[model samples]
Target chain A: MSKVVKIFHGPQHPGITGNMSVELDLIGETIVKARTHVGYLHRAFEKLVERRTAMQAFTIVCRICVPEPDPNEENFARAIEEITGLEVPERAKWIRVLVLELSRLAAYHLWMGGQAGSTGLYTVPQWSVGYRDYILDLFEELTGGRVYHMYIIPGGVRRDLPDGFLDRVSDVMDLIESKLPEFDRLFFDNAVFKKRAIGTAVIDPETAIERGVVGPPLRACGIASDVRRDDPYEIYDKLDFDVITEKGGDVYARALVRRREMEQSIKIIRQIIKYIPDGPYRTKIPYPMNWKLKAGETYVKTESARGEFGYYMVTDGSEYIRRMNVRGPAYVHGVSLLEDMLEGAQLADVAMIMNSLGTCPPEIER
Target chain B: MCTDNPGVWEYIANWARKHSIWVLAYGTGCGAIEMPPTMTSRYDAERFGLRGAATPRQADLLIISGYLATKTLKRVIRTYEQMYDPKYVLALGSCTINGGMYWDSYNTIKKLDLYIPVDVYVAGCMPRPEAIIEGIIALQKRIEEGRAEGAKKYRENIEWYKKNQREVFGDEMLPDYTWNFEGGI
Candidate 1:
């Protein structure tokens, strides 16, 4: 007979990243019930957006998802474009794809670091984060900031790619591609990582579909439901790359999906570099402060590194937005699916399982 | 083996303080992004003995990285309470000091020290990895000099801190919607 023991794992656990907690009811090392505790990092971002001007809200939207912030900017830009009936220049579209894919690469690198770190494979974090900094350096050159690029605006991006920007990006991609084999040796092909990650936190295809898992976690279960492929946005349809998927639906499968996706991201970036048209990167909006969007609502979804990142914007012919709802991947991954998946899993696997889902607390808290 | 040295315990504690500074990774906002780079090999914070701890109970330092909304402040205060004595608070980024870009924003507190005792303030909108290392070094100096008594003083005046925390988080032990003021931008 098993006795139930309760443990509060976070709002501060190393396994659980960011400001969130999980109340675990355990029978020995195996977990019986896991309840997620949020509100630790809750800033009421959706409500905060309702009060700010449309342009001011642009800065705030990036805070919704820290790891894949570009999607929020892209969503805001697209929604505003739909409302104002603005046409994104062909060059800007390609540039948007460039930014998005670069963001995807950066995000995937960070995810790989976190997932590996959670499983006690410390070297993966060391290598991946160091590599990811090269991407951040590019961001610092392209935008002004490393993490919050606030460069994507309503009409278009803030500015065109700088002189020799493409070369810099290509060089970074080259370096990242070259480093992949070493990462494989250190992490992917390593026996310890393979042994711990394989078959752990298995979410069968049926369960994944039932839980509405999106992005790599969903694709890891062998569903090729990439928003970029199915519902083409920007230049994704034109750009050729395979949507990587795996059938295992475990921690290892998720890691494999992300690893393959990084390669795919590199391919996408190469396409953007080769075919980027020479034109204006941004279309002028009248003036951000005085600009009033026409009365309309648009729901735009983009595949971010973590999963399907979507924004629903409702404008009421005013300077301020009427309603803005952020549907982050964490809602499905962290809250709904996390609770169900933790059942019967060993206590030690909690962090690994959570990291595999790629739960961004800001995304969920927003 | 030195019987004459009465300050040997202090010497050992000082040396341990330089190497084994356990960090409470209290991520508050956007500046939290810079932490991974510092912790990773590029900056390698572990060389100086800065390791991220899960619970505040075992941590010797609390790194409040980035902005703190009124909602986040409540939990931060609670976490601070749980930390053991001889702990030091390191405030990273300008946002943690004077709210940086969000200074005008209603939700974010203007001064972090108004709520909690901060020993070191790392000034940058988002400080560079080098700046973070400098902050840690400065903190180590303070610890060695015995000037890092803010945590002890905070424990002594716990009620005052709790009161300040309640003003933001409210009288309830945990934050509720009433504490959330959805003022206009």
Candidate 2:
């Protein structure tokens, strides 16, 4: 008989992406079976959203995915707009595009740190996290809240861009671009990272698609499928950028996809800054607290930094939302894909593999 | 060499504990995202002796970053018990204070202090890094003054804490992992 021990890898471990855990049964250092355990971070967002009106629901939706929250807000707003037939202003669309891209950039910066940190590179986290502060500073100036910017709402963004906001965004973009070479030296191009990531937890392209993997992880499998490219949302059709992809579906390939995508996001941001038209940022809605939505159900999806974030809203012609369901990419990545990938992998590579998938536990448990 | 007053020894011990606080990098909720900035270069929580610990046994500061659902609370309680004496629990976000945003949620506990003793509470939907740093500074002050005796308080009223914890967790409560049952926390 073999002695197999079960170890819980999270809900507290620094290696874990969020407040989630992986239960691994190990015979020595090799994992025999892996089970992903969530619910640690679940705040019952769907239930809470149903109890609140569309305007009130907007605030809580962003908390569904903490790391990249703007996409949830965007999806919520777009879904409500689609249901009520509210036309968003032209400039508001561009501003939404800018916010999404900036959120993507900030998220990727943090992911770069996580990917590097998982591989035992301390310098990358220090550098990348420090750099991400500039993006957060820009957010603070624009939205009035660094983390949870409840700016994007049903009618439009809460307010117009602050004075010189675009210029500051441009400066931050330039600063990030300038630091790319140093980032490559410390993280992307580092030999040790490549060696550690190249063959670990490789996913078959066919399985990845069947498993419903989206965003960089899917693109890393040589299948260039992006929500922005396929189903145009916001002003993405007008924006000039490429859907970056890589061949192998390993950690390195995912990192490479994210790295290239960061450049694409920067390019998109630059275009927005140069070409943004001045117009009324928001269209007025009736008294928000008492504003009733028509009876309808619609689903809206946005390409968040992690993957496709979709929200399904059902309004029963009532002031309070009838039902709202969040469809986060983490459901596939954090639970099913994570369990599928962790089997038979080395214990040391658990965190590395999890980070590669970019699983957010709040989204999973929410 | 051994002829030293206990009061002097306590002073030195508290001073050492005040600095070099090893926080459990657990990320209990959404507020966890802010931790990266606070601990990393920008806020540099390390300058004030706050660094991350890999496990509960090695940690002195437990930062419950956001709202604690019942499931997470079970583990948090276990982790809290596993920690050595003089542990400090810094409840981050308004959720922990009184379920700030998720006030009506079925899952999230209203008051974090009910389950685990909190030393400091950084209030915000998700408090910024500056607020987090301020909380840490305040915690250090409490430690230096020998006022941050949450662990001792926990031991003194383990029954009350466990009762509150059990009310939420029910029969599926964590197995007792108490290290010192005779005279220590």
Candidate 3:
């Protein structure tokens, strides 16, 4: 006879990706069943957005996900821009690409830390997170806020690049690129990480597609499904980059996909700095407090550090929004997909698999 | 041993507690993002003897990072009660102070101090690493002055705090394990 002991994995767990919990039924060290519980980080962003004007909503959307917030900002601004048919300046397009790529690089660095930390390689976190400050420094220089940069507004970005900002961005990109080899030695190339990560939480291409998995997790299955490459929003089509993919759909495969994408992000940012044309950073919009978009609805998605981060917005020809719904990657990855993946798996691999999937709870609960 | 004042052991204990603050490695809300940078290299809060403790039982400080939903408020209470005595709470963001941005949102609570006794409130939409470190320094100062008695305040006014928590939690109140202590935590 098998006895099942129940345990809750989070809500306050260091191993948890964010403010979430997983209820597990374990027969010894093996998980017999798993259930995901949310609502820990719920702030009702959609409802709050509906009550605010278009301009005000753009500022708060970034709060939907903490680690990588630009995707939310991009999605919200792009949605409003699409609804109003606002023309973004060409230079602003390039600058938007720069911000998005930098945010992606910062996110991947944080992810590297989390992925390594979960596998017991503690030194990686100390290095990766420490170095991520360089990017935050650039963000602070550009947008004046380190973590939450309300820079990407509706028409385009909020402001132009500060003098010599591009040079600093280039410098930080170089620094992060130079450090990758050492990170590889400590994390990706390490024997322990390799042994624990490979062939674990394998998600085949067919299942990945069927379950609506997006971003690097989908790329790990050799699908090469990048929203940047596929949909070509903003200046993505103009930029030169590859949709990096891998064959295996395991933890190692996802990690490898992320590692390669970090290089691609650096390349994209380098190209943006090289070719960003001089022009107005943002187009003049109607006064923010009284601004109203035509009664219309649009769905926009971005290639966040997670797979696909989306916002479905409806405006009623007034300052207030009719409806705004978020389609976060974590809703699927953190909740349903996680429960299915956790069955018959070792408890030790739970955090590893969660990190591999990039399951963020704020996105799920938001 | 002097019960009132001037005890060497008490002075040493306060000094030790002031210097080394073990924060619970729990990310409650959006403000949690700044924590990595604060603990990591650039800001390097470890230099100030601040680091993450895995569980509340081991943690000397609980930082309420941002606005809390009523649902999370229950868990926060349970976690707070589970921690040992001499613990402090640092509520971050204007959300904890007066619901900064989400003042109208139904799910999030406006004032954090109503439910939990906060030792320090770092005011910002999302405070910078320097600001968070400043808050920690302030907390350290309070601990050294023997004024950061949040846990003691919580223990003594458990009924009043429970009343506010119950108002927020309604019928979904947490079990009174910390108060009863029948089976011993």
Candidate 4:
């Protein structure tokens, strides 16, 4: 047997999904053993939320997942909405769905860039990341910030949609929809991606279930699992979309599930733009600092682009949340699932697997 | 001294460095999400000669994209030390300025410059792609003006930096060889 060469994949690597590292003990480029190292990006989100008021906590929760912040905001809002018996307005519900789907689309675009960039296909990142901007423009118009939309707050959304915002959303949807075929030509159907991504890092359905795999990775295993369909939040139950799934349970399958879901996101947004009712965007929320939630415990999950994102909250009838624990999908997939998958895999496939699993470090550590 | 008065060779080197910046984007926090749009197609930072460098050794610019967790700060220092001289550090997001939204988070460090020299700071919770490109332009201008002397500042004040790093990291501080500038790894 060849002697093992130990290596760290990131906290600083371009190939790494985020600010997390994997320790790989390899022999001839095949990983013999893999261990994950986190806390490189830990901001101790769980601890910080316990001290802040409900309104103050809302602003920070989105920071938990950089690629998809809305899911966190949605889950946080929904958790309180459930715990306190708060009611979101009808218009706010539709707008929240629009925001969630838009963020999901933006995340998938970002994921495509990561997945494609990992295989050294440079053009796909350029195309996809650029297209993601159109959605961001819509977000900026609606929420006034591009990356972190702090719009989906406690009772409802922060404000009403801008005039003609739906029209703009539709236009962006049209543009992104029009470009999907070109992406298909360039990436999904590309021979190079298929050869490299297929059969590399296959997650069998049993293993996927055993590991508590969620989101696209779970669906990619042919299990058809999704939080939106299973436990619908916001207007997700009302919206029509499939839990896009694929067999083979490899990097390509995960990529396909996300790619197909982009259309469903566009479709959902189109429906939202068509069916949304006009009224007060948000119900009256209590004072920002002095609001106390009812003493209760609740768990809420949303289908983030990565998979199921959840927040478990306990309020002791105080202005501050008694406890808020995040169940970010990466917590499962990034650590244990990832280490298991990396064993015997080529050194190169490390990045590919991480992207396929949608392992965001912030979520794992938060 | 080079920060104030650049020799003829220094001017030429700075000119090259200003034009062709190889960025090793250390995605330490949430601000990393904006980097793709900045580097890839939408903003296309390459038009300004800004591109992603795979490793620290090959990089001229280091972007601390958001709040530096104490653990990440150690790695950032190691990364900064591994990079050759004349390198610039561009700090993105308000987190690096004053811990941004993560100020209360125990693990996160408030100011980036306390641990390493920062040449430019682009402030926002997460600065937009345009803002990041503008920050890159600012760094480029600083390089051309011979004002972006972060690496030199780091070398000169390594003691203070190490002290601050040690304070936060306690016994978990990085190995000395990583920051031993005169020893020359």
DockQ of each: 0.36, 0.88, 0.85, 0.83
Query: Per-prediction RMSD in angstroms?
Result: 5.5, 2.1, 1.7, 1.6
Runs in model 1 lying further than 4 Å from the true structure = B1-19, B69-72, B99-110, B174-185
Off by over 4 Å in 2: B1-6, B177-180
Clashes in predicted model 4: 2
Each model's chain A TM-score: 0.97, 0.98, 0.99, 0.98
Worst 10 residues of 2 chain B by lDDT: B1-10
TM-score-wise, the better of 1 and 3 is: 3
**Across residues B130-159, which tens digit of lDDT does each residue of candidate 1 receive?**
899999999999877667778656655766
lDDT tens digits, residues A1-366, model 2? Answer: 589999989878889898888999999899989999889888888888888887888888889888888998899999999999998998999999999999999999999989899999999999999999999899999898898899888777889998888889999999999999899888989999989999888888999889999989999999989999999998899988999989988899999999999899999999999999989899988788789898999988999988888888899999988888888998999898888899889999998998889898888879
Q: Give the per-residue lDDT digits (tens) of candidate 3, residues B130-184.
A: 8999999999998887888887677668789889988888888889867658633
Better of 1 and 3 by lDDT: 3
Candidate 3 lDDT (Cα, whole model)? 0.89
Better of 2 and 3 by DockQ: 2
lDDT of 2: 0.89
Q: Tens-digit lDDT track for model 4 on A139-188?
A: 99999999889999888998888788888888889999999999999999
Per-residue lDDT tens digits for candidate 3, residues A1-366, read: 489899999988999898889999999999999999999888888888878888888888888889988888899889998988999999888888889889999999999999998999989988999888889889988999888899999898988888998888888988999999998888999999999988899999999999999988999999978889889899899889999999899999999999999999999998988888997989999888888788998899999988888888888899888999999998899888999999988999999999999999888888
True contacts kept of each: 0.39, 0.99, 0.94, 0.93
lDDT of 4 by residue, B1-185 (tens): 35556589888988887889998957877888888888887788889998888889999888888888888888888898888776889999898998777777788888888888899999988888888888988888898888887777777787898899889989987888866646643
* Structural similarity to truth (TM-score) of each candidate: 0.91, 0.97, 0.97, 0.97
